[model samples]
Target: MTAPPTAPATSNAVGRRVSWQTGVSILVMVCAVYLARRHWPVIESGAARLAVADRGWLLVATAATAATWVCSALAQQGAVARPLPARRLVAVQFAASAANHLLPAGLGAGAVNLRFLTRCGLPVGRSATALAVKATAGTVVRGFLIAVLALACPGVIHPPHVPAVAVAVAVAVVGVGVVLLKGPLRRALRAVLADVRAVHELPARAAALWGGSLAFASLHAAVVIAVTQALDLPLPPAQVALAYLAASSAAVLLPTPGGLGALDAALALALTLAGAPGSAAASAVLGYRLLTVWLPLLPGLLALGVLIRRRVV
Candidate 1:
C-alpha cells in the first residue's frame, strides 16, 4: 500500500522534470528558427538570386566548412598524445558539433567529448584534459590567425561596427594569452599534470598542438572565403576571409549553446558591412548554419537515442 503511493509520486516527479527540460529545448529551438526566418526576407529580396548565379563557389565553401571537422579531429589526436583511431576522433568531432548546438553554453559539447573519449578507452582524466586542451587550443589558434589576417587586410575585416568588435577580439586574445603565458598558468598546469601523471602526461611539444590547431583554423578560413564567393557577393576574398574569421572568433565568446543565433548575427552583420548586400551575407551565413549545424542534428539525435537506450551516457 505504501509502495503504491511512493511509485505515483516518483513517476510524477520524473514527468515534471522531463517536461521542464523539453520546454526549455523547444523554447530555444523556436527562438533560433524565428531569427533565421527574419533574415529570410533579406535573402528573398535578392540574396538568393545572387547566390544561385555562383552555386559552385558556395559548394566549395560548404565543403571547406565540412572539412573543418576532420581538421578538428586531427587536432584532438595531437592533444591526446595517444594512438586514437582516426574514425573515433572524427566521430567525436562530428557528434560534439551537433551537441554544441543543442546543449547549454559548452557543457553539453564538452560532456559529449568526454563521454566519447572515455568510452573509447581513455581514462577519465586524460580524456577530459585532452578535450579542454583541444578546445582552448582551437580558440587560441583561430583568434590569433584571424587577428593576423585582419591586420593585413584592414579594409575587409573592418566592416561596419567592426572596429569595436575587433578591439574586443584583441582584448580577449591578449587576456587568454596572458593567463597562459604567465607563471601562474604554468604552475596550475604543472599541478594538474602531477595529479594526472598516472592517467597521462601532458604533451611537451606545444608546437604540435598549435600546428594541429592552425590546420583547423586555416581550413575553416578557406571555407569562409569560399562561401563569400559562392554567394556572388562582390566582397574581396581577403576581406571575406577576415570577416568570417572575425565573426567566427567573436562567436566563440558567446555564452549561448554552440553560439547559435549569436554566431549567425555576427557573421551576417559582418558580411553585410563588408559590402556583400545584406541578403547575400545573411543567406550565406544561414546556409552555412543549416549545413554545418541543423543538417547533422538528425543523425546526432539518433546517436543520442542509441546512447541513451544503450545506457551509454
Candidate 2:
C-alpha cells in the first residue's frame, strides 16, 4: 500500500506551525530592537548616574533587586498546587523579567511562565488560572501597600483634583464596559476565585502567595529608596517608597514594555512633586533603572536562551 493520505496533511500542518512560530520570533526581535534604539539615551544616562552613586547605598539596591526575582519565583510557586523545581523556578523568573522588558503589559513574562507551567505537567487551563491568581495577588498587595504608605506618609503624594463631570463620565464609561463584558468577566472571576480558594486552603501556598507578592512589591520600592539615598536626593525613605508605589501603579495604565519610558517619566514627576529637585529626581530614576533593569538584563536573557535550548520553557 502507498503512504497513508494523512501523512501529507500532518507534515503540512507541522510546516505551517513552524512558520508561524518563526514569524512571531522575528516580530519580537524587531520590536525589541526598536525599543532599545528609542531608549538608548536613557540607558546611557542611567549608567552614568550609577557610576557616581554612593557605592554603599548602591550595594543595598543591588541586593534588593536580586531578592525581587526570588520573591517572584515564590509567588509563582504559590499560585500552583504542585511543587516546582526550586532552582529552575528561580531561573525562570529571572528569564521572565528580561522577557517582561521586551514585551508590553507583561505579555512576555506571562507567556514564559505559561510555557513553563505546561512543561511541568499542568493543563493549559490550570496554568492560565494560576497565572491569573498570582497576578491578582500581586495587584492587590501593591495597591494595599500604596494605600498604607500614603496614609503613613501624609502629603507624600497629593491626589490630583478632578472635575466632577470628568469623574462621572469616566465612571460611566467603566460601567458600560463592565456591562458589555459581563459574561466573560464573570467567568474569569469565577475561575480565579476558585483557584484562590484552593490555593489558600494550603497554608504554605497561601503564605507564599501573599507574602511573596508583598515582599516583591516592597523590595522594588526599597530599590528606589536606596537609589534616592545613594544620590542624596533629599527625600525621606517613606516618601520615596510612596512615590515609587504610586508612580509604578499609575505606570501600569500605559502598556509599554516593563513600564520603561512611562514609569521613568511618572516616577521622576512623582519625585519632583514630593519635593525632590528636578535634577536629583531624574538621577534617582536613572539609578533605579540601572540597578533593576540594565544590570541584570543580559544575564537574564542568557538564562532565557539556555532554558530554551534545554527545552525547559
Candidate 3:
C-alpha cells in the first residue's frame, strides 16, 4: 500500500515570509510623500481652501471617474466569449482598482483581475490573453489622446524640459510604429488575431472596448485636475494635460507596483518644472494619490471578502 503524503515542516514558512519588494515599494512611497513637501503650511492651507471652494466640481469629477471604471468592465466583456453577470464583473473590476491603488507596479489590480477571471471559469491562457488585449487597447487610446492634447495646447507645448522629452518620445513613437507596421510585425499580428476567435465574433465589442478606454483616460485626467485645484496650484488645463501625460506615461512604463514611488516623484517633478512651487506640486501629487490610490482600497477589501465567500474567486 502507498504511504499517505506527509506535510512538509516548512509549508507555513512560505505563508509567513514578508514580500521585501512590496515592503520596499511602500517605504519609498512614504519617503517621497513626506519629503517632497517642504512648506507644509502653504500646502495645507491651499488644499483646505480648494476642497471647500470646489466641492461641487470635485463631486462631478468623482462621478466621471467611477464611470470610467464601468467602461473598464465593458472592456473585459469584449475579451471573454462567455459572459459572467455584469454586477459580479463590476465588483471584480472595482476590487482590482482598489488593489491597484494599494500595490506597486499595478500588481494588486492584476492579481485581483486574475483571481476574478479564473473564478469565472476562464483558463489561464484565455485570461492572460484577455488582459493583454485590454491593456494594449487602453494604452494606445490614452497615449494617443494625451499626445494630441500635448501638441495642440500652447501651455503644454511650452512647459519646462518638455522639448527634449517630446523629441525623445517622438523618436520612440516613430520607431515603435515602424516596427509594428513592417512585414514580420504584420505577420505576427496576423498570427495573434488567428487565435482570438471569440474576440472576433462579437459585434460592437470593438466599440465598447474603445469607448471604455476613452472614458478611463478622460477620468484619469480629470482626477489629476481635481487634485491640482484642491491644492490651489492654479495650473491651466494645458499644463495639467502635459504633466499628467508625462507622469502617467512614466508610471505605466516603470516596473514597480502601480508605479507608486515613480508616479508621485515624476508628477511632482513635472509639475514643478511647469512653474508650480515644489510644495504645491508635491501636495497635489500626494492629495491626488490619497483619493485615487489609497481611499479606494477600503472598498477593495470588502469586495475581496465577498469574492472569497462566493467561491467565484
Candidate 4:
C-alpha cells in the first residue's frame, strides 16, 4: 500500500488554501473601496440632497430598500421546487448583495446562490438552470411592465427613432447569426424549454416565479419614487416610476457591477428628462443609490464573511 499522507503536510496545504482565499477576498474588498472612492463626489452630492429630504419619507424608502432581499429570496425559491430554508435563503441573499457589487455584471451573486443551492441538494446543472429561470422571469416581467407603463404614459415615454434601414440590417444580422449557431442554440433552447415546463407544472411555483419577479422590479422602482418624494422633486409618481423602469432596463445592457456608473448616469438622465432640475435629479439618483447599494454594502460584506467562515455559503 502507498504511504499514508502526513498530517503536517495536509495541515500546511489547508493553511495555504485558506490563506489564498483570504488574499483574494481582501483584493476584492480593496477594489470595492477604490470604486467607491471614485464615486465620492456623487456620494457627497447625494448626502447633501438627503439632508433636506423629509425624514418620514426617507424612512419609508429605507424600509422598501430592506425588503429587496426578501423579494430576492422569494424569487429564488420560486425558481426551483426544492424547499430551501427560508431564513437561510434570506441571509444568503443579504450576503450575495455585497458579493454582487464585487464583480462585473452579476457573476458574484450567481456564484453565491449556485453554491447555496448545491448545498441545499441541487445538482450543479439544476442550480444554474434555476438561476436562469428566475432571471428569465424577471426580464419578461420587467419588459411587460415597461410596455404597459409606456402605453399608460405616452407623453413621457417617447419611442426612439431608429432608421428603418438600420433596423432591417440589425434584424438580418441577428437572423444570420442565429441560423449559423442553430445546433448549440437548439440544444440550449430544448434544455430551457424542458426546465420551463417542469417548473410551471407546479401552479404555486409558477405563480411565485412570475409574481415574485414582478414584485421585485416594482419594489425597486418604488424605492426610487420614494426617494424623489423625499427630495420634494416636482415629478408625478407615475412619471418617476416609468423613468425608473426605462433607465434600469437600459442599464441592464451594461456590464457594471450593480450597474455602478451606468445606473447612476441613467437614473440622473431619466429624472432630468422627466422635468426635475439637474441638481435635484442628481440628488434623487444619489439618494436612491445610497439607500439601495452603498449603505448596506459594508454590512453585506460582513455577513458574507460570516457565512463563508461558517461554510453556509
**What TM-score fits each model?**
0.68, 0.89, 0.70, 0.91
lDDT assessment of candidate 2: 0.89
Candidate 2's TM-score reads 0.89
Every candidate's lDDT: 0.68, 0.89, 0.69, 0.86
> Tens digit of lDDT per residue, candidate 4, span 1-313?
9988799898999898788667756765675577578777766777877997899889988998888899989988988987799998999998898888878789989999998999899988888889989999999998999889888878887668999999999999999999999998887777677778988998888888888888888888999999999989999888898999999888888989888888889888988998999988988888999998887877787677766655677
Ordered list by TM-score, greatest first? 4, 2, 3, 1
Off by over 4 Å in 4: 1-13
RMSDs, each prediction? 7.1, 2.8, 7.1, 2.2
lDDT of 1 by residue, 1-313 (tens): 4544687888999888667656644554564465456645643544444446467876776677678778777777767655677765676677667667666678866887787678778888777777767767777787787778778776666434658788999999999998778896776576445433522344543544667788877876676677666666788777777777788777767778778778789988888887888877877676666556655555654454445343344
- Give a tens-digit lDDT track for model 3, residues 57-176: 667556766776787898877766677679988888876776575566767777778778887888876676677777877888877986787777655444346588889999999899
Model 1 per-residue lDDT at 304 = 49
**Residue 82 lDDT in candidate 2:** 89
Which stretches in model 3 have alpha-carbon errors above 4 Å? 1-53, 101-103, 154-192, 195-201
Candidate 3 Cα RMSD (Å): 7.1
By lDDT, rank the candidates, best first: 2, 4, 3, 1
